[model samples]
Target: MAMPVSDPGRTRVVVTGLGAVSPLGPDLVSTWEAVQSTRPCVEPIPEAWEAFWKPKSRFWAPLPKEWIQCPLLAPLEPKQLDPVSILALESARQACSGGAPAGRGGVFVGTGSGGGASRFENHLNHLFPQKEFLPGRRGGRFNPFCIAMGMPNSPAAMISIKLSIEGPCRTFSSSCASGTVAIGQAAQAIRSGEVEWAVAGGAEYLVDPDGTQFHGFDVASTLTRIPTREECNRPFDAGRSGFLFAAGGAAMLRLESERSARERGAAILATLDGVAENCDAYSPMAPAPTGERIQQCALEALADAGLLATDVDCINAHGTGTEANDRIEAAMLERVFGRGPKVTTTKALTGHLIGAGGALEAVFCVQGLLDQIVPGMPNLVDPIADLDFVLRTQASEHRNVLKLSFGFGGHNVALVFTKAGTP
Candidate 1:
């Protein structure tokens, strides 16, 4: 299977549509509005926290139940829809509605801890003291579809099926970097002439009590038991503790170019100039603290776009609020830009959406270009180092934005986006 490469000058990737299902909102417009306002989407645990690992952290960004209603799951009863399926469908539908091209469209979605909550819930039910010992009870096979929907690739498959995307369909699960990797792959496919259009994004829905317990046990999350959402996530701030857990989905459509989208009368959202992905191979959970690989990723992406660091006016950082991540990312940007660009972390507003974070933040980058505004870090009261973090107020002047994402498995991805009219 050889991939056909187009003339280097023949193909150009562009963003024609965008979609999102986040704690901030269910769709792109709403989410962008929420981001501009610096709203805090984190909240206290919906149910009894005691049931989930002694309530080390009482807050998280959980999506609403109604936010998942989508056309993809119309065949299934509402109660039967898994959270992951709901997220994927919602994101896909929104993207499709926004002008995904007809015949040649494809799908690629990223996910982490797919359907973990459903599996945990089923296991707990089977373990009940008075449970009947049915034939499948021990193995907990009551819902056969559970496993089908729980697989990491389920989101991509479901989106493909729902959208009737008969072309390439795939899923990436590189921890938090999954979304950006998925989008980067989609863009590469288009550039290689493999597909004309693609629905690319990521989803996450692991907010169940037992699922929270597992995360607590992992000790990777920031256990800040703040009573209010405003204080939960503080990216690039000295007071920042760790990454806040969040759940949601995000999607975008990668088209061949504006000419192709215009031929179909599709609404052009933004220009996807270039994307680059690399791995540090340094550590499984931690990034190469020197930030060399990620810096290279940024440099590579800028070169792909034929642009310079000075040309980038803003950057959507992978600021996870974790000490190591924020510091490393800050230093990397400083080294690359000499002085860091106007930087912000949406994770402070939406918490960290794990695999979905990068895709969702990429959407924010597009919005920044389109709306001429860059979101601010919501609660970063105390500054860290000498970086210029847009805090509490959105920036109104941004032409080119760089979106960066790093994952636990040493994955790093950078996307460069220019304004619609930019050369």
Candidate 2:
């Protein structure tokens, strides 16, 4: 069933702020520089994790520990909150900091690793007391607030509590596409007159002290088996092996109605032109070989924005670096735009953030428009498709950007963004 969307004539939504905690750096500025440089953040998987099991993949893109210790970010003690909630709370803090709390604001956040920290810690400890199943930690005790912290909605609720958002608060759990869906839903609410502004994005910290996530993905043969960290991160390349699994991180965008932002004298960064989401019932973990649904999603998003295929100048593709995914997505983009738009894959730099990947890419899309450049991919040695991949940072006056994200469970979401000051 279709949800009721707002009349485009009534309200228009725009982005006013952006925040992120990424493997490349702690804040948006530092990370953007690293991103522009095409720096790969993968590292040798620490030997400490070997106590549990040996893995097929040798490198991991773990979130920087220093970022978590940054002051005055999280709403509560960092230890009390799971890494997922902490990442979300910190990004939300940064996004909602300067402005006065939005009395009628809503909170929409997404997370795929809500089960990583508190969930495992509490449950494993209860089942086996004094057993050091997880490295650097003993599983002998449990906390009273374990249940609350482990809840998937904890990240969204924490943001609402910290920022005093008084409207509908929701946590989207669409796996890798979670962040994109959250931001899209928030934009819909504003356009529909349900909220004045909303904090929307996603965070993930799947690295457990015990190595649960590593073993699972590695064993499934979906992680990069390349020997060197530098060689392992490749997107849209003929030799692309698999995605670089990041430890965790978060990214958030503060979206407001155009009128509210103008009245408050807020600096508008980008116009949220349109958004659309759908599911591919074809598979639970793989996109259909026909590639019909993914293509339809992109076209639908443009229609929602009242735009045509020729209007878009760039594409922020959900390039996971996996052979199957890259081939499928390339086919879809080619069939739709036919090598017209500059397709950029950011996973080469940030790795596969899973839940947080989409939100971070959205932030990059806004940043790219502001800088008037598209990020390059030096790691992709051979072209996998005919699409125009930005091989190096190139200056451009491109306005409209399409950000696409597809999750494992066939969740497909597309969002269209226009440069600020565009009619």
Please provide, for model 2 over 1-423, each residue's C-alpha lDDT reduced to its tens digit, 9 standing for 90 to 100: 122332458588899989899998888888898877877698888787787787888988888777875355544577677778778877887777678534379999988877467787678778877776554667866767888878899889878887778799999988899999999999999988889899999988887767788788888788888888678988888887788999889999999999888988888899998799999988777878888888889888888877788778999999998878889999888888878899998888888899899999999999899888898776877988888899776787799999999998999999999999987
112-217 in candidate 1: lDDT tens per residue?
7666667676665556634645533333345656667557777787788777889999989988898888898888888777888888988877666445533652
User: Lowest-lDDT window of 10 residues in candidate 1?
Assistant: 1-10
Q: How many residue pairs clash in each candidate?
A: 0, 0
Taken over the whole model, the C-alpha lDDT of each candidate is 0.76, 0.85
The lDDT, on a scale of 0 to 1, for candidate 1 is 0.76
The best candidate by lDDT is: 2
Flag regions of model 1 displaced more than 4 Å. 1-10, 75-80, 98-100, 125-141, 221-229
Clashing pairs in 2: none
